[model samples]
Target: YKASIPKNGGPQIPDELEDPKAFKLKMETAIQATLKSEKAKGETYSQDEKELMIWYNYHFLGRGKPTTHIQVLSSVNNEQIKKNLPPVFKEIFARISSKLKHQS
Candidate 1:
């Protein structure tokens, strides 16, 4: 995903979010929140969730396709939440990217 983002000229993380664990935790929390909110509003899972579920089923479940709506709507609120991160959080992301490039 990071690789693809650069190809499109998207904003890069600075130096703060470089740790894989921190990145994963942040992403997970955001996705879970998105899923919960969508479920509450009865909007069904979003496009990103569909893509992720498809990948999970193919790789983890060894299936040709997703078999259940539950799996499709599992959890993507984390990503949605990320879309609305506060300014401080954005700075952290920028810092993470800068650190990756050794741009002290």
Candidate 2:
């Protein structure tokens, strides 16, 4: 995992490593919330979850694949997330580009 610096430019510790059990709980809570919300919004929940799992798997599980021929990770700019992902996710729709990085 990338260690991130705070906006105040202060050093910070990643707490997820501090308590593995608590970290699992947090993961469960977030996933459950996503399940409920995604289901409510549309019929695409299963496909959505599949894509999410693939992206996260690449990030944390060392597995790789793009969803529906779309490279979702490359669509996100880490700097852009520093702005849009705060308060809540402002999802940027993926657009086809000749450029996108991937690892197989």
Candidate 3:
């Protein structure tokens, strides 16, 4: 199974996450290399960030369902992800949260 992040409210498969374990391993490599990759860039990941990364990898990359995505998104403690991720990602999350809230 594979999970992905959406580039335009649609699925985007990251080449690095082709192998979940490999991606996880790559995440721990030297900061310089991570900085060179657009996926990681120069930012240092906190525990929350790491968890989100793993979860997303498993969810989108590993074929986790949309309902699961909704549940996870609803449960997320967004302060950290909101602060760390790009504005577009934050907006996307907000939109998903809003849509899910309205659905319930």
Best by TM-score: 3
Report the C-alpha lDDT of model 2 over 66-99, residue by residue, as the tens digit: 3412344456677865664534333333222222
Better of 2 and 3 by lDDT: 3
**lDDT score of residue 98 within candidate 1:** 90
RMSD of 2: 15.0
Instruction: Please list the C-alpha lDDT of all candidates, in the order they appear.
Output: 0.47, 0.41, 0.54
Winner by lDDT between candidate 2 and candidate 1:
1
Clashes of each: 22, 0, 7
Worst 10 contiguous positions by lDDT, candidate 3 = 1-10
What are the RMSD figures for all models against the true structure? 19.0, 15.0, 13.0
Residues 1-104, model 3: lDDT tens digits: 12233445432324464777665554543232424454564356775565455445445544556866675566656685566588888789899999999999
Output the worst ten-in-a-row residue range by lDDT, candidate 2: 95-104
Superior candidate under TM-score, 1 versus 2 = 2
Q: lDDT by residue for model 1 over 1-104, one digit each (tens)? A: 22222254432223334676754443344444434443332236574664354334333344223443344335436786578678899999999999989965
Q: How high a TM-score does candidate 2 get?
A: 0.25
Q: How accurate is candidate 2 locally (lDDT)?
A: 0.41
Better of 2 and 3 by TM-score: 3
